[model samples]
Target chain A: MISKSVAQFVRSLHQKKYRQQEGCFLVEGAKSVQEVLSSTFEVDLLLTTDAFYKENADGADRQRCRIETATAEELTRVGTLESNNAALAVVRMRANVPLLRAPDAWVLVLDDIRDPGNLGTILRIADWYGIDTILCSETTADVYNPKVISASKGSFTRVNWWYGDLTGVLNQANAPVYGAFLDGDDVHQSPFNAAGGYIVMGNEANGIGPNITPFVTQRITIPRYGDAESLNVGIATAVILDNLRRVQG
Target chain B: MISKSVAQFVRSLHQKKYRQQEGCFLVEGAKSVQEVLSSTFEVDLLLTTDAFYKENADGADRQRCRIETATAEELTRVGTLESNNAALAVVRMRANVPLLRAPDAWVLVLDDIRDPGNLGTILRIADWYGIDTILCSETTADVYNPKVISASKGSFTRVNWWYGDLTGVLNQANAPVYGAFLDGDDVHQSPFNAAGGYIVMGNEANGIGPNITPFVTQRITIPRYGDAESLNVGIATAVILDNLRRVQG
Candidate 1:
């Protein structure tokens, strides 16, 4: 049986304030926990059921962290996921080191993406399109938030993110900045001749902010054939990346 | 103020069984409630705050439904949304009449899409891409579920959906069937020459089921350039539709 204080500690990481105070965040579910154990991130503590421990003991044994056996009920009680039959891990947060855009490679820039789920989904999209680096505005949802971690499914391990002022990065950028806008040049027809650059996505309710808009070298739009007021920020990101890859090929 | 009995009745629609029993579902927030009031769908009851009523009194007046003035707190207390400051409406569920495929138009087919948010996001994607009709398996999340309605962001009013046996529909379908598979033809290079057909999407964990597999005339994939295992079903759907529209143009 797990102690009450330990459970309380794990549960505290669910909120951003506690996660910041502790400098660690919770990674719940079997897949995410396994990814974190295998990743470079330091695991502070791991709570796992007997079945999960048995199945992934090799990976768990390799990690330099405290491992405790717990029931599925205990995991569900202390975790943010609706049901977690496998494991939950307390992982040390990485320093927000600036992510440099590699030579001839694409990067994603997020501006004030407030929803945790949207932020996580964007991370997954970035992973899918092979965009390894992400730059986020300070107002964007905390990447360590449990909701963001849960929604990312294990993509959080693959994508590197830095939360800072977007203006400073955009202003210093040497590559072209393409921002998603409603009335900009059609993405399908836009000549993406540049080897690699930055693809900037904006807030859910608001498009790109004024501060970031001027730094945008080009404004791109996914032409709408129907009447949706707008596409979800995550969906728009995927479409933009897909089109960008298609043109580069 | 909404009566206790009426509040209880509206809350009952949150569940599928009661929604089925009463032949009604709830649409929350100002935008969705307004969309329901203006749509062809019948509205049974509408609960609105004074601000929303004042701003949208004309739209509310146009509906042939019971309109009761309630405080924002009462609306939030009675509704599923976390903070509903505007309105909520009890809307009659549409009859599950099979949606006829329009000539030279693509239709979406969903197989066991269990998540309401994914289903709703797909609906919005369809609305954005101009794919108006969707055919879903019976196991798919209820289209009238509040989560689906909220995630759809009023796209439910514009798009049409029918849920039933997938095999029966696919077996009788004359149009080409394209199923999203991990190892299918690269969507970037695939020749989407068909005038109009079906784009089939599967469950979160499972691809298209065995029953629906045989009907797929063309197997397509969104080529992954990175190490992420798979795309979310909704994201995949948007990517496919965007490519389809690009090629068709």
Candidate 2:
């Protein structure tokens, strides 16, 4: 049975203030929860449907994962998303923004990416393409945001995210920093071409924020022949990564 | 000033039945509304914040857009999406999904692709890369879904979309049909493949649906060294397009 105080506490996580106060954020769905439990992330609590707990609890024996069987309705009530998931967990946040070990390599830097789904999707892309580290600016959505966590599928477990000033970081970087722009040299051909550099993607509605623009060695654009005003950030990154990597790959 | 009945009518388009009955769908925001006004797609109605209409009405004259000015409150009452915009347009549905006119070259087929944003983003990718036609299986979400329209960023203006039995379509194609599957041959090693073929992408959660499997000549898989379970459909498509296209300016 979920106590009223527990219910209130779980509901409070929707706001950033409450999440910081608790030092935790919510994760939902069986797949994501299982992925987190298997990783280095510390699962403080795992509330799941009794059927779900019975189905997959043994092999995923994480002593830190304290499983509490609950009804679907109860899980739904605490869920931060529109969909009711089979499992839910409150995991401690990874507060450290570790220095990217190999900074010269292809590191994706997100500037003010506010949408959790977009942020999460971006992480999954990074994982798929074998990008080891991602640096997100301060205004980018929190990595622990529920929507971001869900959209990331399970990629967040392996992907490290941090809140830092992208402008400052890129300015001091040893290699090229490519910022996507509306009118830049074709990404297919640019001199900032090194084995690895920072590929900076900006916010959804806005291009590269002013703070980071000056630091970019080349403002690159995906060759667009059609009438689209701009590609979705996730799509644009994929296009750039595919093109840039093909030349080097 | 928007009337009560009109607001209700506009808001009703959120429901599939209402959209079907009216033979129209909603497109909102400055970019979306502007795209519909500029495109050949017939605009049944237009509602915008007076401030926007006054500033941007000149362009509407070129497209012969029928403009209706509404208060923020009225737009709020009528808008289907969470974020209200400066403008909204009711575009008459493109009821016909025509067979591929240029099926001789590379084509895209979506087998139950569900996400609106993914579908829209895919359409935009198709437009940018010069994939003239995309065939959608019956289960795929409607291309006109407002979320899809908004996410496309106006790429829907060019790409031709059709819904039908994907198997039948594949059977008719003269070239080898390719399907992207986890079990398929590594896409990287696959040599100068067939020129004209239907490239099938599957649903969001599930890979390719069963019906379309038997008809494919080749299965392609993206090599992944990271922990991500799957790539976003839009990303996967862009990656494939980059690989297949004759890469030169």
Candidate 3:
């Protein structure tokens, strides 16, 4: 049985304030915990059921953490996921890394993406399209939020995320910036530069912010055939990336 | 001010059983309620704040429905959305219309898409791409669910949804059946028939079920460039539709 204080401590990480204060965040469920174990982050706490421990405890990284045995019910009580049956881990947050210049690789730049689920889905789409890094405006949703982590599935492990000034990064990096806009060049017909660059997705309700617009070298749009107002930012990301890759390939 | 009994009755529609029994469902927030007013579905009740009623009551469709003045606090208490400052409508559910054969236009076929949000997003994507009809397995989430309605935004008004046997519809469809599979031909390379047909999307965890596999005349895939396991079903749908539109256009 887990102690009440420990359970309380684990639950506290659910809030952004507590997570920032502690410099650690919760990763729950079997898939996420496994991804955390395999990732570069240091595990501060690893609470798992006997079955999960028996199956995955053999890894060397498991020995580096403060591991504890707990029941599935105990995990569900402490975890953000309602139906977590296996494990929950508190992984240490990495320091904010500066954006790197990689002109040959497509990077996703997000501006004020408010929804955690949308941010997470974009991360997963970035991972799927081999876009290794994501640069987010300071106003964007916190990447370490449990909902964002949960929505990303295991793709969070592979995608590098950084929240900083989008304009600063776009200006510093020697790459063309392509923004998703309402009345822009048709994505299907727009000729993408063979050398990769940046694709900036904007806020859900608002398109690209004015601060970031001047840095954009090209404004591209996903052609719409019907009357729906706009595509969800996450869906738009995937659709745009698919087109980007098709053009590059 | 709304009556207490009426508020309680409206709240009960949150559950599927109550909605089915009453043949009605809730549409919350301003955009959705506006769509419900304009649609063919009869509105049983329209609960609106004074501001919304003052601004939009001039519309001709408002005369056709029972319009009630309600406060924002009363709406927040009775509705599913936390910040519903505008309106909520109790809409009568339409009878399930059988799937129509749309050989010349795209019809999205869903197999056990369980999440209301995914189903809703798919409906929005369908509306965006001008795919008028969505055919779903009976196992799919209810189209009238409040979460689905909210996620679809106003696109639910434009899209026709029917839940029935997938095999029967595919067999009867006079056009080619295209199924999204990981092992299928690359969608970018695969030539889409200019005459539109059916595009079958699968469930969250599983791909297209075995029973539905035999009917797929063409197997297509979105090429992945990175290590992410899979795309969310909704994102996958929009990407596929974008490609299909690109090919057809």
Tell me, by lDDT, which candidate is best.
Answer: 1
* Candidate numbers sorted by DockQ from highest down: 3, 1, 2
CAPRI class of candidate 1 = high
* C-alpha TM-scores of all predictions: 0.98, 0.93, 0.97
Q: Which CAPRI tier for candidate 2?
A: medium
Interface RMSD per candidate: 0.9, 2.2, 0.7
Ranking of predictions according to lDDT:
1, 3, 2
> For candidate 1 chain A, which ten residues in a row score worst on lDDT?
A186-195
Residue B180 miss distance in model 3 (angstroms) = 1.3
Candidate DockQ values, in order, are 0.83, 0.59, 0.89
Candidate 1 lDDT, A1-249, residue by residue in tens: 789999999988989899999999999999999998999888999999999999989888889689999999999999988999999999999998998989888889999999999999988888888889999999999999999998888999999999999999989999899998877888889546467889899999988898999999988999999988999999999999999888775
Q: Write the per-residue lDDT of candidate 2 for residues A1-249, one digit (tens) a residue.
A: 777877787888878898888899898888887787788888888788877777767634654466677777888887876666477888888876656638446888999998888898898888877786899888999887888899999889888876887767777788878888988877656434666888899998887888888888878877765555667788787767766655565
> How close is candidate 1 at the interface, in terms of C-alpha RMSD after superposing the true interface residues?
0.9
Worst 10 residues of 1 chain B by lDDT: B186-195
**Tens-digit lDDT track of model 1 for B15-74:** 999999999999999989888788888988889988998988888878867889999899
What DockQ was computed for model 1? Answer: 0.83
Which lDDT values do the candidates have, in the order given? 0.91, 0.79, 0.87
On the 0 to 100 scale, the lDDT of residue A232 in model 3 is 94
Off by over 4 Å in 1: none
